[model samples]
Structures are given as C-alpha cells and as structure tokens.
Target: MGKANDVQFERARPRIWDRLYPYLSILPALIIIALFTVYPFVYAVRISFFQNLLTKPRSHPFIGLQNYEEVISSYYFRSALTVTALYAIAVVLGVLIFGLGVAMLLNSNIRLANGLKIIILLPWAIPTVVAGLMWKWILNSDFGILSGILYSFGLISSYIPFLANPTLAKISLVMAHIWKEGPLAAIFFLAGLQLIPKELYEAAKIDGGGGWRLFRNITLPLLRPIILIVIVYETMTAILVFDLIYVMTGGGPADSTALLSWFAYAEIFKSLNLGHGVALAIIIALITLVLILIYLRLLKTEEINV
Candidate 1:
C-alpha cells in the first residue's frame, strides 16, 4: 500500500508542474513590469498628494489635492489646454486628409507610384527631434531653403519669420507634425485599401458607379475600422506631443504652442515642483484614458452596426 501511494504521488508532481509552467515562464516579465511601470505610477500618485519640491526635498509634507487644485485653476493651464485642443484637432484632420490622399495615390498605377511608395516612409522612420530640427532649418527666416526658393521665384519680398509669428508658428507646427506622422497613417490606409476586393469595385462600376460614387459607398465603408484606429492613435500622439515643441518652438512667441505635456514638463524641470507636475501628469493620463474609452465605444458600435 505504501509503495502504490508513492507511485501515485510521483505521477501527480509532473501534472502540477505542467499546470504551473506557463505562469512560471512569464514571472520574470511580470516582475519587471511591476518594478518599472506599476511601482513608478503608484509612487508618482503618492508624491502628487504631497509637497514634493526639489528645493525642499527633505521636507515633503502631505498636502492632499492642493497640487491638483492649483494646476487646474492656473492661467497657464487654461492656455495650454486651449492650445492642446486646437493642435489635436488640426493634426487629426490634417493627417487623415494627407494620409488618405497619399494612400489613394499610391494605390493608383501612376508612373512615379513605386518611387513615392519607397520615399514616403522616410519621414516616419526619422526620430521626432531630428524631424523637428530639419523643419526648423527649412523654415528659418533668414536663410531657409523655402525662403530662398520663394525669393528666387519672386513670390515674396523677403524671408518670413515662420516661427516668430504666433499664427504662422501654429501653422508651421501643424505642417511639420503632419509631415512626420502622415506617412504611417498612409501606410495603414494603403494596407486597408489593398485588402479591399477588386471585384467589389468592378461590380460597382458595372452598376454605373464612378470614382466618387465608388469611393463614397465602397472604399469609405470598408476603411472605417482603419480610420477609427488612426484617429485614436493620432489624437493621443497630438495630445502628448513634447519633443517637437521642445526642439522647434520651445512653447515660444507668447505661449501659443505650449501644450499640456509641455506645461507638466515646465512644472517638473523648470520650476522644480514635482508634486504639481505629477498631478498634471495624472490629469493628462486620465484625459487620454477617457478619450480612448470613448473611441473604443465608438469602434464597438461601428462593428456592431456593420
């Protein structure tokens, strides 16, 4: 009886190990995530409830939600919020239009389509800081290539300060952002366009559908999912934009380009107010989370309707 029991126990040990193996394999990754992401987030949240100024590092005192209240009630917050809103809206629309147009053009059998398909992704591959620097040089008031070209063509009396004027600065930022991000969106759209069956277009043509008619009915409907994805992604990217602003504008010319992220950055680095910065960071995170949830709800509704 004792020998039989030992055999049964030995057999069950392997079964138990097999059941636990998958989680054991991924335990290291879970530990790393807890250390890096989860721990930092919780610590930051705790810090936001305290007066964690770098200058007074040894004297952090619990201040509850004062940091949140102060950040929200400030003038800079209002201005940054407005600028962020405008930037997000313009970027989303610009990227969508540019991406869809480029995708459609690439899908066509034009002579330069192959060459363009190769070159279009270059901008997306470059780092954001590098792209911003390139645009800064291109838009330089005194000796920019664009200014020189315009001068040679007699299009302007002199070089324009693209980064100095508030309105033009906003426009220039939008253009640079679109140029940097539009390529990925175009690739996404092109992939979606390719997946669409040629037979559907042929059938539509048989039913007397022209370019606009076929696009409005067939192409647009089929690409709805991709469009929603692009919108959500681009919206988040636009909201969290910082590197470009740092490299190009520095939130300059009267804070016309200061975004929420930039505001948080200024609070943390420039002002050395860790609590306020963390509070603002949490607010930004919540805003993005809400937007993502809304977009996800829309995506679900779309899927159900289709």
Candidate 2:
C-alpha cells in the first residue's frame, strides 16, 4: 500500500508542475512590467500628493490636493488648455482631410500612384523630434529653404518670420503636425479603402451614383470605423504633443504654443516643482482617459446601430 501511494504522489507532482508551467514561463515578463510600468505610475501618483520642490528638497511635506489646486487655478493652465484644444481640433481635422485625400488619390489609377505611395510614408518614418527640427529649419526667419524659395519667386518682399509671429507660429506648427502625422492616417485610410468591395462601387455606379454620391453613401459609411480610430489616435497625439514644441517653438512668441504637456515639462524641469508637474501630468492623463472612454462609448453605440 505504501509503494502504491508513493507512485500516485509522484504522478500528481508532474500534473501540478504542468499546471504552473505556463505561469512560470511568463513570470519574468510580469515582474519586468511591474518594475517599469506599474512602479513608475504608482510612484508618480504618490509624488503628486507631496510638496516636492527642488528648492526645498529636504522637506517634502504631505500636501494632499494642494498641488492639483494650485496648478489648476493658475492662468497658465487656462492658456495651455485653450491652446491644446485649438491645436488638437486643427490637427485632427487637417490630418483627416489630408489623409482621406491622399488615400483616395492612391486608390485611383492615377499616374505615378505607386511612386507617390512609396514616398508618402517617408515623413511618418522620421522621428517626431527630427521632423520638428527639419520643419524649424525650413521655416527659419532668415535663410530658410522655404524663405529662399519664396524670395526667389518674389512672393514676398522679405523672408517671413514663420516662428516669430504668434499666428504664423501656430499655423506653421499645425502644418508641421499635419505633414508628420498625415502619412500614417493615410495608410490607415488606404487599407480601409482597399478592404471595401469593388462590387459595391460598381453597383452604386450602375444605379447612377456619381463620385460624390458614391463616396457620401458607400465610402463614408464603410470607413466610419477607421475614421473613429484615427480621430481618437490623432486627438491623443495632439494633446500629448511635446517633442515638436520643444524643438520648433519652445512655447515661445508670447506662449501662443504653450500646450498642457509643455506646461507639465516646464513645471517639472523649468520650475523645479516635481509635485506640480506630476499633478499636471495626472490631470492630462485623466483628460485623455475621459476622451478615450467617450470615444469608445460612441464607437460601441455606432456598432450597435450598424
């Protein structure tokens, strides 16, 4: 009887090991993720409740929601919110228009379509910081390639300071953002366009549907999912934009381009107030989360309606 029990126990041990093998295989990755992602997020949240100032680093008193209150009540917060909203709206709209246009053009059997398709994604391939630097150089007040081209054509009496004036700076920033982000959106749209059945378009044409009619009815409806995705993604990107501002505008020319993320950076490094920065960052994250949730709810309703 004892020998039989020992053999049964050994068999059960293998079964238990098999059950835990999958979890053990992924344990290392779980540990790494916790250490990097989870730990930092928790730490940031904790830091936001303290008085973490470089000037008084020796005393980090518990401040509760004071950091959040001070940051929210400031004038800079209002300005940053406004700028961020405008920038997000403009960039999302511009990217959608530009992307849809490019995608439609690529889908058509136009001359050099293949070549254009290959070249169009180059901007998206470049790093955001590098793209911003490139744009900065192109729009430089003096001796910029764009200014040189315009001067050569006698379009302006003098080279325009694209980054100096508040309005021009905002426009230039928007243009740069569209150029950098439009390519991915175009690719997304193109993929959606390709998935659409040719038969649908053919039938619409047979039913006397012209280009605009077919697009308004068939193309738009079919591409609704892709459009929503692009909107959400572009909105997030626009809200969190920092590298471009850092490289191109530095939130300058009278703070016309100082976005919320830029203010967060300023609070942390420039103002040397870690608690304020963390709180602002948390606010930004919450704003993004709320927007995403709203988008997801709309998407669900859309799916249900369809």
Candidate 3:
C-alpha cells in the first residue's frame, strides 16, 4: 500500500507542475508588480489615515479620515476639483469631435493624404514635455508666434497672456491636449471606419440614404466600441493631466490649473504634507475606478445587444 501511494504522489507532482508552468513563467512580472504598484498603493492607503510629520521622520499618528475631510473642505481643493472636471470634459469632447472630422477627411482619397497624416501624427509622436514647452513658446504673451499673428491681424490692442489668466490657462491647456491627442483619436476612428463594410454604404445609397443618414445609421453603430474606448482613454488622460499644466501654467495664478494629480503632487512634494497627499491620491484613484466601471458597464451593454 505504501509503495502504491508513493507512485501515485510522484505522478501527481509532475502533473501539478505541468498545470502550473504557465503561471510560473509569469511569476516574476507578478512579483515586480506587487512590489511596485501594489505595495505603493497599500502604503498610500495606510498613510492617508495617518498624521505624518513630513520634515520629521518616524512621527505619525492614526487620524482616521480627517485628512480627506480637510482636503475636501479647502477652497483651493474645491476650485481645483471644478477646474479638473471641466478640463476633462472639454478636452474629451474636443478631441473626439475634431478627431472624427479629421479621420473622415483622411478617409477620403484626397491629395497628399499620407503627408497630411504624417503631419497630423507629429503631435502624438512628440514627447509630452517637449510639446508642452513648444506650446509655451508659441503661446507666450510677448513674443509668441500666435501673439504675433494675432497682433498682425489686429485682433487685440495688447498682448494676451494665454497661460496667465485662469480662463485662458484652461483654454490653452485644452488646445494643447487636443493637439496632442487628436491624431491618436483619428487613427483609432480611421481603423474603425475601415472595418465598416463598403457594401453597407452602397446598400444605404441604394435605399436613397444621404451621407448624414448613412453615418447616423451605420457608421456610428459600427464605431461604438472604438468611440467608447477613446472616451475612456481621453477621460483618464484628461483627469490625470499634469505635464501641460506644469509646463504652461505651473498650476499658478492661484492654483487655477491644479488638477487632481497635480494637486496630490503639490501636497506631497511642495507642501510636504504626506498624509494629505496620500489621501488625495487615493481619491484620484477612486474617481478613476468609477469612470472605468462606468465604461465597463457600457461595454457589457453593447456586448449584450450584439
């Protein structure tokens, strides 16, 4: 009986290893992720409920959710939150609408279409920091190319500070975002557009469907998945915007352009409030999760309909 049991155990050991081999191959990546992403996340959550002295080490007290309450109640946080929400919405809408228009244009067999596409893709290919810097130069109040052009056209009497004023700062940031992401969005839309059957358009034409009608009936329905993906990506990108604002406004003019990411960063590094920063970071993560959940729900509905 002992010999028989030993043989069975030996056979099962190899079978178990065979079953687990694939997972074992990915174990290193899983370990790295746990060490970096998961550890930091857990640490942040722990610190969010603590009162930590930034300048002094090894001094922290558990304070429940007071940091969250303080961050929520602050006027600076409230205003920045509003600006962040508006910035996300505006950038997403502008990128989608403008990108769709550009995609439609590129889909046509126009002259220099490839060249145009290459030019359009420049923004997406450019490093974000470089793009922000270039725009800062162009949007500078005194000697910016745009300011010069506007001056040449006699649009305004004095130089307009695009990044100085709160309203103008938001507009400038949105414009930068559109320039950076529009081409990427167009590429996605173009891919979706190609998958749409040419026969569908022909059929629509046979039924006396005009351009608008065909687009409304066929193009939109077919492109819903790509559109949803773009929306999700754009939303997350906009919410987490930091580079543009950092380069352009520096979250200045009384923190007008302070997005949630920037807000958390400012709290941690600038103000040296680790606890408050961690709390804000957690809030940002939660908001992002909520947005993702909404997208997943919509995706599920679309799948069910299909």
Best by lDDT: 2
Model 1 segments more than 4 A misplaced = 1-17
In model 3, the runs with Cα more than 4 Å from the true position are: 1-20
lDDT of 2 by residue, 1-306 (tens): 255578878788889899999999999999998899998999999999999998897999999999999999988999999999999999999999999999999999989889999899999998999999999999999889999999999999899999999999999999999999999999999999999999999998999999999999999999999999999999999999999999999998889999999999999999999999999999999999999999999999999999
RMSD, each candidate, Å?
3.4, 3.4, 4.3
| Residue 52, candidate 2: alpha-carbon lDDT | 98
Cα lDDT tens digits, model 1, 237-296, are: 999999999999999878998999998999999999999999999999999999999999
User: Between which residue pairs do clashes occur in model 2?
Assistant: none
CA displacement after TM-score superposition, residue 57 of candidate 3 (Å)? 2.8
> Against the true structure, what is each candidate's TM-score?
0.94, 0.93, 0.91
After TM-score superposition, the amount by which residue 126's alpha carbon in candidate 2 deviates from its true location, in angstroms, is 1.7
For every model in order, what is the number of clashing pairs? 0, 0, 0
Model 2 CA deviation exceeding 4 Å by range? 1-18
What local lDDT score does residue 33 receive in model 1, on the 0 to 100 scale? 87
Error of 3 at 206 (Å): 2.0
- Superior candidate under TM-score, 1 versus 3: 1
Model 1: pairs clashing at backbone N, Cα or C within 3 Å: none
